[model samples]
Target: MTFPRTLADLSTAELGSGYQAGDFSPGEVLDAVAERIAACEPTINALWHEDLAAARSRAEESGARWRSGQPRGALDGVPVTIKENIARKGVAMPSGHAAGDPQPADHDAPITERLEEAGAIIVGSTVMPDWGMLSSGVSSRHGITRSPLDPALTTGGSSSGAGAAAAAGYGPIHIGSDIGGSIRLPGTWLGLATLKPSFGRIPLDAPYLGRCAGPLARTVDDLRAAMTVIGRPDARDYSQLPPYSGDYRVPDFSVSGLRVAVHTEAGCGMPTDPEVAAAVDAAAQRFADAGAQVTRIAPFMSEELLVDVDRFWRVRSWVDYHGLDIEDQRRILPYVARWCTAGADVPGAELLRCYQSIQTMRQATVAATEPFDLVLSPVAPVAAFPAEWPMPFNDPDQPMGHISFTVPYNMSEQPAASVNAGYTADGRTVGLQLAGRRFDDAGVLAAAEWFERSAEIAAPERTVG
Candidate 1:
């Protein structure tokens, strides 16, 4: 077997089957991946810091295990790329910013350790904007990552390189983190699968932050397989809940008695593009046709809740980039510095107010949507923007303009996903954002799978199975 259209083209089961049959060894797959990375690196600008030799060494070890009939773990030979923000022992884990001291990471972050333990070789670290403060993928340290579909358009950030690499066929699965639309927006722009699980479903531990991290793949099945490997609980991360109960097995997504709220303005001031609105409207009808009750609401969050989430995100920026050296600070993208400074300006009381308001909003959002099982909205206000331009949300004056749809869920700690609804006449993709209540990851994934299977949008070029 050879590389396929998507990194997910060969399902996890198929990869295992290939390994069992001796059709292709991990070394051979690694060679193909290395070639693809070299071939697309110029245009896509995906993989940032890499050690191809290290990746090959791991592949050789995996090949030895396969020959001995003692595979290391579930993703034994799978080549996976991780976002730069997540730590991997001994590898430089710069968050697309110049390092102050550049000290070696003492240990792999919990999620990275889990991936390594499962035998997925860390081929390279994908790039992100400094501290993930910006959403447009441009950073002084790593340059800008462009969309595989159109190099001129934006490849959503700060999980930017993960999406571009996956789209450019570097590997079958790439890990990414999301605080506010980092994963979903990039996935939407690149025409890939992005699963933003409930905040605490996946363990996330780091030197400075605790945002969630998960895989970005070309198919939902691939995502599920990867999640099984990396989404386990870790004592290092206190925010993680216990392993999900098997009791929530999703039945064939029957909308028969399900209540879904369709909120165009997800409790923010941003306006959905006409094309995006039309696509989401059609998707809601499809959900209705599938036998579900769909209701359109003005917005999803309370006014106060929206304000709080925005403030919280801004404050976190200060926490992420504090005490950096001047050169490191200068190496950050303009937008990252802008947000970090904005975060610095937030007073102590305002930050505390935001956290307190989060509780009220969570409760209010839950109560308001008690009658609904799921919520549907646009993933990004527009399909994809120009790569060099600042994202609407990065503009502090337009907090409600860009991240209007995404920030609330981060505050609520819900499970949300972006599915490729359809493409615009100009060829940009529109994503339908589907969200489920806290810990209802299975439900959200099931709903996303339903829509992904229903809508037959073709994956972008240069992806691998």
Candidate 2:
């Protein structure tokens, strides 16, 4: 039994089957990933840390388990990477900031523990924006994470390296956290599959709002496999939902009777690139052709509501910034510095107002989508922008434009995902977002799988040189 192509090219499910069939060993998979990462790292800068020696040892253990017909679990021998923000035992959680103490964590985040227990080989940590604040990949600590499809383009963040690594085939699964669009934004830009599960679907031990841990993968099947292992309740996260009892396997559901609403703008008259709008429109048409009910709808959120959400996020960043020493704060990226300062003096009344606004926005979103099984929109208003900009707009006055399509769902605490819609004529990748009612994560994933099947979205050609 021998693998004809690079093991890095196989999906997580494929790799699992290959291991079971004795076509390849987990050690071979890790070696293939190391080779690909070595070729791609100079151009992409996707990983911040790696432990190939440890990963190889785990792979050897998994091989022994497979040979004895006592494999530990579903993910045995599968290569996996965690975003920089996640706590991996013995690995420093820098969160992409230059100022944090370099001491490593003594315990694993629940998700990390679960993955390891299931026999997934932990490869390394992926890069992210400073403190996971930015939507693009430039971080003061780890530098920029460029897209594998086109080096000049941004791999959206704060799950920047996860996107780039998944695209470059460093591994089949990556764990990423999303506060606003961290997971989906990068997934869209890098033409990967990612899910931002409903708030509390995956427990997180962080001092932030709307943060949920999720998986970014080359295929929806791989994403589901990772979710099954990591999406369990942890006592550390009091906010986590009760232990999920539902099967993580994407159900066989036809889109024939599904009701999907399409919105190109966030209803605030935000600017959306024509190419992105066209791609989303085509995706909706494909659903319609497949017998689903599709309708173009007005944006569910207003510009003022979006501004308030941005304000709250900035204030949150400000709080985190001030917690660090003044000298350490000075090490933050300029844009992050700007964000921190902008919210430093917000009035208490204004803070309450922002929370009220978020509540209103959530209610509005729930009401608007109640009539539909799923909602379709562009993952972002534009395709991957120039890598140098912190965001597509990068304007201090209107920094939320690129995230208009994504942030609303975060505020709503619903399950949402970014699936490869298609590429623009200029070769930029476009993503179609599928958002479902809160706690309807399975429905959302099923819809994404349907789209993948119907659209036949292809895996990206490896860009490593």
lDDT of model 2 at position 373: 92
Q: Encode model 1's per-residue lDDT on 1-465: one tens digit a residue.
A: 134443334656677778778988888877877877776788778877786899889989888888899997668988889998788778677777765645556778887788788888788889987777677678777787788778888888779999888777676788999876788888778888888878877887752222578778777767777778777788877788888645333876676678988877655556678898888889998989988999987665655666667668777766766667677767666666666576788888888888888777667666766678888888887888898765744465545456667766775788788878888888888888888888888788778887888776665553322
lDDT value, residue 201 of candidate 1: 79
Task: Report the alpha-carbon TM-score of model 2 versus the true structure.
Answer: 0.96
Candidate 2 clashing pairs? none
TM-score of each: 0.91, 0.96
Per-model C-alpha lDDT, please? 0.76, 0.86
Q: What is the lDDT of residue 263 in candidate 2?
A: 88
Question: Model 1 Cα displacement at 280 (Å)?
Answer: 1.2
Off by over 4 Å in 2: 1-5
